[model samples]
Target: MAEIQTTTLIDDLTGKPLDAEKAHRIHFSVEGKTYRLDVDEKGADEFHAALDRFIEVSTKVAAGGASKRAAAAPRRASAGSGEQTKMREWAKANGYEVAERGRIPAAIQEAYAAAN
Candidate 1:
């Protein structure tokens, strides 16, 4: 059997971090509310699985945020119509929904016409 590492995250009612550890048990009190976490070997395994899921989700969120920030940065002029069509087709095939409107607010139609 593979050895599993466990991690815990304890928070108060206000969502403030109380404690964190890599042990199978945790005890803490917050705002007069006491809490105890005791996990057996099986429970520890499950807890580790949950922690893995959280790490995966957090990584994905951070990556998405970074991607959005990068995309928000200004780029060179828009691509030509042929390139745009190829991009739209690629997006559709990859299960991404492409907006009908162009990136430019005004002169979009004119720009697209000139590109083609």
Candidate 2:
């Protein structure tokens, strides 16, 4: 007898799995609500491409403070989809137990920023 195991990641928008690559997780905010999505490389690129123009023109905001724009819970990854992936990868490499999905911890985010 033989035993085998497999795990497949599906794209949130397309509900399809990539043949050779795992999906990337995307975190974004709109109107004050935040969301997380898992997508393949092409989908990740498309999401960022659609937002690049707006991102280039938008002012950067600090993550925490009494400032009006500060989120109720401190948030990270105003950075584009690629950068967000980098941050998550960095966190895992540096001994942080980041999940394959969901929010990365604030400490991990701060360390990533400081190191970069």
In order of appearance, the predictions have TM-scores of 0.24, 0.46
Question: What's the CA RMSD for each of the models?
Answer: 17.4, 24.7
* lDDT (10s digit) by residue, model 1, range 36-70: 76644455577567667756765343323433534
Clashing pairs in 2: none
Assess the local accuracy of residue 6 in candidate 1 as a C-alpha lDDT between 0 and 100. Answer: 67
Candidate with best lDDT: 2
Model 2, span 2-114: residue lDDT tens? 99999777778898885545568888777656789798888889999999999999877665322365448864437677777999899888888887766667788789999
Cα lDDT listed for each candidate: 0.53, 0.79
Note the clash tally of each candidate. 0, 0
Clashes of 2: 0
- Distance (Å) between predicted and true CA of 33, model 1? 49
